[model samples]
Target: MKFKVVEKFTSINGEGPLAGQLVVFIRFAGCNLNCSYCDTKWANKDNVCYDFMTSNDIYKYIKSTEIRNVTLTGGEPLLQEGIIELLELLSKDRSLHVEIETNGSIPLNEFGHIENPPSFTMDYKLPCSNMEDKMDLNNFHGLSPRDTVKFVCGTMEDVQKSKLIIDTYELSDKTNVYISPVFGQIDLEKIVGFMVYNKMNGINLQIQLHKIIWDQNKRGV
Candidate 1:
């Protein structure tokens, strides 16, 4: 299987519950949604620093570096046609723990064919993202506790919308929910206050840890 890779490098798992762990990042090219606050807009465009790589090529890089965790991030990795084959190959080596960062627009059930499913960090776009209509809540129906739902909060409206969706779907029961402030847009404390005021449960506050630890403007970790 051929995978179009935007870039690959080693970095901390900058978001979600695994914020500080070192991991190899496999950034794929292509996305189904274009959110307004998207930082990686270049990845959505037609041409980027992309290379067509096979599963062995990716594995070799990982092995060379001795990294055990691999994050399949995007431009929505699931949108790539060869993603399942890539995941299957990655799963064979039990030493590696695979994680996928997705937009949550695609149905997780569609990936049922992948024998050993990787943990998913699913982003549920809110109103502030200007892509609310694109999210499909049914996709969260069968998500396991190992999977997480991340909401990028750019504005108060986004936070409110996220709360409604979280409650409506009863997401707190099956998975961990995360409310991450849009990098550089809103104050983290303010968003945390909102979460506290609402008495929200089972939700964690997160920031882009890599941006904090390294140059914010740089790509490829």
Candidate 2:
């Protein structure tokens, strides 16, 4: 099946548990929700030029890179049709460690039964994002240690809400949970203080390393 591919490039995993690791990123176009801090807004616009590549073509491109880590990002990669086929094709390659960076509004259950399913780095859009109501809480039930639930906080309210979600779901017991500040919007120290005060044992704090390493507005990493 063909997919709308905005860009494909080799880069280090900028966020999540795989940070700093070499990866091949396949960025698809379009999204259902618009977060206040979305960096890839350019990719989500309807007129963005993109290539139409089949699952086999994408699989071959990843093989050419010879990079073991593959990150399927987006404008919400899950919004694409025929994504399951692509995931299945990628899973057949034993050498690849696939990860999908998903916006949390989508359901994860459909993806769970895939053989050797790709790990997910999901966003739990905090209130500051203005898209919190769109999140599908059921997705939390499908997480495992191989997955990550990330909260991008811009205020103390957002941090408190993140803590409530974490404790309510016991997300740390089910998966890797991370809290990061909205780039340039909140002080990192504030998030640290909340974590320290709450004794957030299993949560990790991260920054978008790519933004620090390169022009934050630059594409293709």
Candidate 3:
């Protein structure tokens, strides 16, 4: 089976708990949701040019690299066909730490069947994203403690909603929780203050480390 791979490169883990770590990023093409601040709109367009490669081919390329941590990112990696096999192939590497970045809508049960299931970096879109209703909160219950649940907030309302989601899902206790600002908007100081005021010691405030290192709009590191 083959995948429509947008691009693959080595870059610092820009978000989540893995931020600042060097890792190989495999960004797959296509996404089901359209967020207001989506950085990779090119990935969502079906007409965009892409390299079609099989999972084995990808694994071989990664095997050649010195880095063992691989982030299977998207345009919603879950939406791509034959993705399970791709993930399965990549996970076969005992030294590799496979992380899947997904918009929380997709079902994760299929990953459970995988012998070496990848840790999920699940994003719960907030009100400002206009895709909050698309989230499947029920899916959070199935995630293991090793997975990370992130919320990208652009406004104070989004921050409020993030807190509610954590409480409702008991996310901080279940998995690693992160609340990141939307690039330019929603300054870190404001979000940090909100978190501190609310006694949210368990949750973390994160930013796009890659954007800070490179340009915010730059793709492929």
Candidate 1 backbone clash number: 0
Off by over 4 Å in 2: none
lDDT of 2: 0.93
TM-scores for all candidates: the values are: 0.95, 0.98, 0.97
- Residue 156 C-alpha lDDT in model 3: 90
- When 2 and 3 are scored with TM-score, the better candidate is 2
Residue-level lDDT tens digits of model 3 in 54-147 = 9898898888878988998889999888888888787777899989999998988777988888999999999888888888877888888779
Evaluated with TM-score, which candidate comes out highest?
A: 2
For each candidate, the alpha-carbon lDDT, in order, equals 0.86, 0.93, 0.88
True-structure Cα RMSD, model 3: 0.9
- Hey, what RMSD does candidate 1 come out at? 1.3
What is the clash count for each candidate, in the order shown? 0, 0, 0
Q: Pick the candidate with the highest lDDT.
A: 2
After superposition, which runs of candidate 1 have C-alpha atoms over 4 Å from their true positions? none
Q: Which lDDT tens digits does candidate 1 get at residues 1-221?
A: 88899889997888876778889998889898999999888987887779989989988988887988889988999988867777888888889888999897888887766777889889999888888788877888978888999999998878888899899989999998999888898877778888899999788888888788888878877
Model 3 pairs whose backbones collide:
none
